[model samples]
Target: MSNQTFKFKQFEVNQDQCAMKIGTDGVLLGAWASIEKQPFAILDIGSGTGVLSLMLAQRSSAEVLDALEIDAMAYEQCVDNFEGSPWGDRLFCYHADLAEFTEEIDDQYDLIVCNPPFYSEDYKTENTQRDLARFQEAMPFEHLIESVSKLLMKDGVFCTIIPFKEEDQFIALASALNLKVDKRTRVRGTINSEIKRSLLEMSFCEPARSDDKNVINTTELIIETTRHNYTEDYINLTKDFYVKM
Candidate 1:
């Protein structure tokens, strides 16, 4: 639970050099993101400690696992984490901004995942690294969507976790780009708490003409039933990574 490092069942992420440490959001996205097609290539945008890519490597037989980190410190830390991991041969980190990467990379990925910063409000902390990693201005939702539209394969799945309040707007933006939501899950901290996050899976493929609608599969996930009490669904989803789950 320290910022220095996070120990997972199959991997240990040393995040001392990174501004963003391992968190529930990344773990949830890593574990919940659909790997149904057994993606041969995967990309993780804004990989902090390379934990999300590491988790995907552990779960899938993907031959190529790439991650992108704009921050120099986090990028170096991500490369170190990936190199130390068992999937070192398969994992790689690019020290470039999303825009540059998207413009340069021509290869499309079977799956793309991003746990983006959502703090859109004008706020600043003395810690510049933390601010860059926590603020949405650094990588707006529009940029993320545009990058995904270009880098994702026609049948590829794009998964992301964002603030629940932004779910509608996010989906609308994706829809404008012809991306349709295939699956969605609203997440709450506890049974009594309001929805805090939304896990979404979208694809560029259009629905059948006969169907016309996207037919999104929606569900809800409560992380805990009470204080420190993890729900069975939550545990089942993340138990493979979190040691104590």
Candidate 2:
């Protein structure tokens, strides 16, 4: 769990240079994000160590797997990791602010994935880079959704992971931009633990909702039945990426 290199099934991520090291949230989002559309281009916003982009590259035939990392150290490391990955030819990293990148990039993506900064609290840590990576002020949900709404293709899917408490608010914001929820999974560490995170899949195009039944497919995911004893669903969802799943 130290800020060091993390080895996966098909690839290894060097995280020594990144303030925000690899975590379960990013891995879960990468593995759970649907790629059924067979996207040709993919974008990973706030890519951190570029692990999400790497995972998608390994799972799909995306010719263009681009990652955006604003932090200088993380961005440089992301580029290096992308170059070292097996999908080096397909993976590319952009070291620019998301707001600017969204404005400058004219091409739309078939799939857009993000493990965005979630915290919106007023606090500061001794380590500024970590704070920037973890806090919402660095890239608020508003800006993230606005950019995704603009950059996503007509049929493209946008997937992300956020706090369970923020699910309602986030979905409401997305709805305002005409992004409808396709699927949602509430995540918990253990069966007894309160819901911790939410995995969301949204798109610009969605069929009309039926009054008789729910339109957005929703489910619950328990990561572990007990400490280090992963649940069957959790293993199945992340086995492709985790080294010892």
Candidate 3:
């Protein structure tokens, strides 16, 4: 696959040499990760193509943004993308696993976002690059939670998108590390379909009044409709990155 340049509202991502190309999961996590007050330091775990890190750069005024990737190809692609971006000075991609990055970094981050591999099944693909980008064997839920628990600051927000079926289990894992879910949004292709993915934001301290289930859109015509015609909300959410969205 060739490296392609994906244009966003405020940035363009050049992802020619990445194992995981631009996908809905990365775009959703990038657009959905909250940066309300603007974080000072941010971390993107398993940063493939550095899309989420770039999105966070556009969303907040963070001085330092770092990305950690275990895959060598993805790490190189991330470094290239970051260096080509305007925020190259502040954005750095480390060619290391998440656990290693967490152990070496002494600084805490106010925002930590990850588009983790959640497909915990006994399956394999012919494409080794995609497998490395999509598989979560090296970094399980427990391992990620423990690493984040140690790296996240007192008021930090750890954001991620996981399969809806694993939300309960994922939350349970995070809770073991004393990280409570502050906000979550269950996404569906349409109003009638079952929820497919859950975008969650967690923090060390439980909110005084935590809310549940912030449904984003309820449109039936997107998936069932023609290939080219997408829903308004879906288009709105991804218009910035997708070429024709």
Residues 127-196, candidate 3: write the lDDT tens digits.
Answer: 8887877777856889889999999999899999888899899988887787888778777766568888
Q: How many residue pairs collide in each prediction?
A: 0, 0, 1
Candidate 2 regions exceeding 4 Å error are: 205-214
- The lDDT values for all models are 0.93, 0.93, 0.81
What CA RMSD would candidate 3 show?
3.7
Once superposed on the true structure, which residue ranges of model 3 sit more than 4 Å away at CA?
1-3, 206-227, 243-245
Candidate 3 is scored at a TM of 0.86
The TM-score-based order of candidates, best leading, equals: 1, 2, 3
Top candidate when judged by TM-score against the true structure:
1
lDDT winner, 2 or 3: 2
Query: How do the candidates rank by lDDT, highest first?
Result: 1, 2, 3
> Clashing pairs in model 2?
none
In model 3, how large is the Cα lDDT of residue 234?
73
Ten contiguous residues with the weakest lDDT in model 1: 205-214
Model 1 per-residue lDDT tens digits across residues 167-238 = 999999998898989999999998889999999999986655875766889999999988889999999999
Candidate 1 achieves a global lDDT of 0.93
